[model samples]
Target chain A: MSTPRTPTIGLFGLGAFGRLILRHLGPHFPLTVHDPVHHDSAPPERAAACDIVILAVPVAAMAETCAAIAPHLRPGTLVVDVGSVKIEPARVMQQTLPAHVQIVGTHPLFGPQSARDGITGRNIAVCPVRGRAHLRIAAFLRRVLGLRVILTTPDAHDREAAVVQGLTHLIARVLVEMEPLPGRMTTASYARLMEAIDMVRGDPPGVLAAIETANPHARPVRDRFFATAAAVARRFESGDAGGEDQRRRSRRALIG
Target chain B: MSTPRTPTIGLFGLGAFGRLILRHLGPHFPLTVHDPVHHDSAPPERAAACDIVILAVPVAAMAETCAAIAPHLRPGTLVVDVGSVKIEPARVMQQTLPAHVQIVGTHPLFGPQSARDGITGRNIAVCPVRGRAHLRIAAFLRRVLGLRVILTTPDAHDREAAVVQGLTHLIARVLVEMEPLPGRMTTASYARLMEAIDMVRGDPPGVLAAIETANPHARPVRDRFFATAAAVARRFESGDAGGEDQRRRSRRALIG
Candidate 1:
């Protein structure tokens, strides 16, 4: 076969993450972007002609967007998604897209700030459906974007993310609700908690909702975090000797 | 009545805070130094003689040190203890010292790193037992050292510190126990926690042990923290249609 032309990138959804990708890859690749809310502000036309189509929308809108874009994609086009919850969107892409197109799901374990700042030392999980397009895309991401691509099943990706992101953010929400932060001269631990809180503080509500509601495995992890915190609290309120006794018993149980 | 001469400062406990004070005040005052461990290796004689008498030792040895140095302290000598816990040491000073020597129990909120550089803008809690030494000490601390003096009862000081320092360190101990951190890229929140852990990482074991065991108020505050964490856990674990059912039930119960 004759040499294949350089792949163009079509990005749908121009929010913070989309904007960052556009900003980073715009100068390198032809980047076309479309966001319903910001339709008039779409990326240049050259970006739309790209063979690679990236869906960078909220999880809620991912399915609808994937279905709508399937007709527009070329026969051999590779469609990839950049959303937190992978399984649902991966399934949607697989179900909606034509047989000639390839579906690859990805979740960049970072935010827009990291991407914009050119900090590429983060993990990006890839769940491929069909064709060598997934591997090609992964290679391009590695060689050009400098992302650490982790190949995994979508189910496993969602399950692990429940604990990693969901549980972490849940603990942060609880801490925020509990007490008024002391003055700046706080212990190192409290400062760390504040940092965690700050990370999740500006996240879009839909992102949290997707992780909390759409991810099938997140509830149990969130439950476990809350349970551990509650158990510690109950033991403390029971009285000094009783609390110490409970702690000792727990330690013994764990060791055994 | 004649105006009393400016009461001189006798710093007992030449650890980080003491050494810092000497570094800053050596040229200005007549400091007499005494550290059982570092008595021979202290910052040359010039910095040592600046103090009227410096008793730099552990908190546990405060009683014996006070008794031994009581004879040497002349009339109007202002002896100050820079221990973390104020109540017990303050009481020890009130009970052990001679009538001519003035005992002022002061805990500089900041530590050695704070002192070696400077003490300006930091807090110093003072529990004055006898003499107008506090006025001179407070003035010197404010003008020369730039310390913000908070005059309070020893009991009150210790009670608040039990929550501030003791509770903080307790949280650090819990977090450290949970995760073995690697030198990989971490989120902002994790970084903050690491900083807190670092602060108490190399502290004198005796200092921590004393704060944990000696402060009677510590147990309860710690207990409350655990209880709150556990309660959050229980809510998560209940699994009665996630948090929705519980929130609805609680709202109904309150309305009824």
Candidate 2:
């Protein structure tokens, strides 16, 4: 069980997702926030004494930010991350944090618009580096914030994300490359694909680079994606039962 | 200008999209409807007489259906089709309909969901085969129903649909084959992609077949899609700089 006192939360980085957190959590908790870009506009002094420190910056900056904040954290304070990629950040936090400070790595499996209210019914993946802090935080997230908690290792999270994010975004990249900007009218299916493309288009360049470059295991998954696309093209070119056969084979492989 | 006195409408097939029209316009206009599966199940007899006849069946079944309803249409009645592929149905309507009757080919660029209260503010592609009757229907759709109307030849409509529907659905088919089913939890991008896959999964097979097989020009689009995917796979396998190089090359191609 967590200590009953209200946890003071120190939020670091104020990007899009970070801003969303501040908007939702500021009224409810004792919030302290830091952003290098907004150094002159720091939060109130009371918030700096927070018991929980959250790193909500790009994945590439996670290591340096974790190192800078380690000394400021008091004993028993929890350091958590909300990065997209997990394993590397978890390793960085483990190496930089003090022995007494508990490190909990989390990837909230949603974005700002996913829920109308503050984090209700959304999934949060927690990979504990070395503490009971995860359970404490998970309890609060479920009991108070109404989040669905998923527990997994940092390694497993990245491996799965390689296919989930890597392949889907790769497909979007392909569509943008192939088609001219659509005009006049569209079907429901095309409208949906455009929505997917729009979601990823505004992501910071580093976010896309990290997902594509960091995951060594994603090569095979991407290869398989291309292979399936090739088979579909072959079928379309032939216009025989072969296309339908290929479609059936691919559907069974994916759905099964 | 349309001939004065409300032009009676002849509705040939009573499928999902057909039934919706009857529900919306049956009270105002005299509607003559025929369907092999549910000929007796059409609305009451008072809604049977119509000046314009709409053929709402699959492209493969259009010829036989046109023959069956040829004797029933009144002189000067306007004939239209609501099929995905336009050329074949347009040719059949031109060949079989009475010389006095005007022929117009229509492809409502929306599904049954858009027709809930009648297809207001939606798009309908109009391909006039041989007549002035299409002008009146187009005017009605634009002025009364608030539809966005695009007038094009039958061949052009089929060509555009080949890339829009055929290639888009082909990409959906490939993605479904390539990726594993994401459990209940996923990144925002994957969640959006799954929404697209669901839409494609639920589409009618007749729509799918018409988009895939009816367009003769779709083969080259499918070929380019496969070639580009293959190139992406090869670049990823070669390492970071190779992938970066491929990205640069693609951008250069776009610029040129």
Candidate 3:
């Protein structure tokens, strides 16, 4: 009953993403932040005491971070995770947090790089795990932050992201590492591929690893992607005249 | 001594790309088109009679098409083949055409799909093979059609394009075939990937095959891409904690 009618927000982790949330949400809410990196940041206990706590840590650290704040979280406090992959984070918050504390998993599709211009009209996927706090936060995300909210289950988010982010980052990381020659002749599609690479490459290795590894569905999609890529490479290597028809047939199979 | 002050243009093939070129070039020059599929079209001999004849056939048909027109071509006529892959076409034109006929291999990097809005500011790779006519065509491409002309060798164009269009169509063909579930939650990078797919997938099967197969360099690039992708997949599949360090090391190797 002592929780404020307008939730006081506590933001955890001050990495680029955490700082991004702070930059945008700082002015709008009664906000305090906790990041071990910053001496001035409120302590871990202070984050637990807030009415709404946002975890913006790397996915690899989700469980430990959740455990750190669980004991101190008020009965009615809402814990929101801003991790890219949602399934494991949702499960961690469910298991580690006090039964009375509410949890919702969120993946803001745009990062500081993509949203450099602004966050208005951008998308944020909300996977409501426990309690009614998700409704409140989704409304806040929509009305206050001008985000288009897609309410999805944690599994659905990961499944789609397996292909979306999974394929995007997988292709991008390899392309960047290849140091592809600067083509004097580039097509519109090729230019767009480069743009996607630029957008995803700014993410840290841990973030990339988490998206690829932590999500269970990601592995299967990744396997299919590589297998198909291998098959295409083999078909090309064979240099069979009939391979064109075979490639088309395989392409049709994949399209389906 | 008369190669006509303004070379009359003859466009061969009436596929989407050929039609696109016609739409842009039709009004500016004395133009005629010959598509065997169309009853009212000018005959192949008529196409050779034009001072500047453009071959817009599929790469598979380039040699035969060249043979059909070579004997009829006026002595000073410039023969341009707008095939997606250049080396084979360049050689075919050089060997099959009359030595008196000029040859320039061009790959307009836009098609009806990419150029739906119009072709201004788009790129066109001009590989001058057997003539000074390329200079005239490049100037016309820059001055009249507003194309950014990149004058490169056929081998250089194919080499870079292996990674550019080869990687593009290869990935696109796979992604399109996968028919990924409609992602209600899409990111900026994901949207760009989809846009690139849409642009390239509209191209016909023959074009896709030619880009992937006819260009010899494409096979090596495709092999390297899939190999690197497979390595990444294996690293993730192993689920080794130290795999991250290993991945970065291999990444450095690839970058070199």
Show the lowest summed lDDT stretch of 10 residues, model 3 chain B.
B247-256
Ranking by TM-score: 3, 2, 1
lDDT of 1 by residue, A55-92 (tens): 77777666666666666667777888888888888888
Per-model B-chain TM-score: 0.79, 0.80, 0.91
| Clashes per candidate (backbone, < 3 Å) | 33, 9, 2
Clash pairs (backbone) in predicted model 3: A254-B177, A255-B177
Best by TM-score: 3
The most accurate candidate by DockQ is 3
How does candidate 1 fare on TM-score?
A: 0.65
| Per-residue accuracy of model 3 over B110-216 as CA lDDT, tens digit each | 88999989889999999988868889899999998999999999999899888889989899888876785456688898888899999988787678778888999
Docking class of 2: incorrect
DockQ, model 2, C-alpha based: 0.21
- Give the lDDT of residue A197 in candidate 1: 68
Tens-place lDDT per residue, model 1, B60-113, is 556766666665566655667777777777778788877876777777776553
Give the per-residue lDDT of model 2 (tens digit) for A145-220.
7888888889888888788777766776667667684556566666667777776766655556556665665666
Name the top lDDT candidate. 3
TM-score for each prediction?
0.65, 0.76, 0.92
TM-score of chain B of 1: 0.79
Residue lDDT tens for model 3, A1-256: 5875666998887878988998998887888888776777788888779988999877777777777787788988889999889999999999999999888999999998899999999999999899877787889889989999999999999998898888888888779868855656889999999999889888866678778888888889987877776676666566642456635433332200
